[model samples]
Target: MNADGDETPEAAYRLLHERAVGQSPTPGERSLSAAQYDSARADYLAEKRIVAKPGVAIWPPTSQTLMKRLGNGSWSTAMTSLGLTTNSGRTRGTGSFSDDDYRSAVAEFLDAAADGDNRSVTSDSFAQYIVWAKERTAAGAKRPSGAAVRQHFGSWEAAKTAAQA
Candidate 1:
């Protein structure tokens, strides 16, 4: 539509759609909207936390009573709907980290890390794990079960080296 326009040559309107619709416009000119915007948001959210898919209706983590009730439900129902199931056939002990429980804990840790709250990792649930891991890696922790505490040369050496560094 300029002064030299020949019958107003077709001016294709280029719209920055994706950015306006809450999407990163760093990629293309194709306007992102409708399901695209939703998918992008869903993917981003899923990375930061658990996401119940379209067919899956995972309940928000709450009381242990509700979790136990759901665990006793139909396998398919829990797997497809609430996103859970029990592996009765497994030889795992009664005291074990369930898949969902592990995932939930990991999600919690990630959330805490994202929020920069290192103290948030002090969960009673993972307290045992912390103790176990610390003991396993603790210097001079290994003993014959009845043996007395001894100063480990390795730990002393490591401490001296770190101090010099």
Candidate 2:
């Protein structure tokens, strides 16, 4: 019951969720995963606009904002309460990559970082490359973080040595 006495935004948002997922959500339940939410949101935004009143169109908030608002001030907290998986897969850390994989990623990053210059791949540079790679590639294809690489080989220099070996 907003100013117009219509369904509240959260309610309408839930209805959109229902329509998108082909199932109604139980009370206080979040039925859409973050990915599904993003897809549904994109579709909703793509559809023709519906004016809520005079100049205002009914619209949903961005995924992070929506989760925060609904989940009581924290996006992760809200997501957890709704039983949604929050793993972005692109999150940086020591992953399950094998030693060989680490060597390959290090080689690739070193080559890319070197480019036409003779710049050496410091831990900082490698970390920056990992960030850049994560953005352009799928989550599974992203390079491990520099810290992970160092941890895998026990040191940055050792990691580079292994890659060159």
Q: Local distance difference test, per candidate?
A: 0.32, 0.62
Give lDDT tens digits, candidate 1, residues 1-165.
223342210110111123234443332233332244335445544655965567654322222222244434322222223332323443422224443433343343334434545553444233433443344336553211101011211332332233233
The TM-score of candidate 2 is: 0.43
Instruction: Please report how far candidate 2 places residue 106 from its true position, in Å.
Output: 9.4
For model 2, the superposed segments whose C-alpha errors exceed 4 Å read 1-9, 28-30, 50-58, 71-76, 80-142, 145-165
TM-score of each: 0.18, 0.43
Cα RMSD for candidates in order? 22.0, 8.5
- Model 2: per-residue Cα lDDT over 1-165, one tens digit each: 233455543654565577687875665554566557767766766674532366564565556656667666544455556554354444333367877888888788767666755344343365665664575356567667667777788987788789989
Q: Which candidate number would show the highest TM-score if scored against the true structure? A: 2
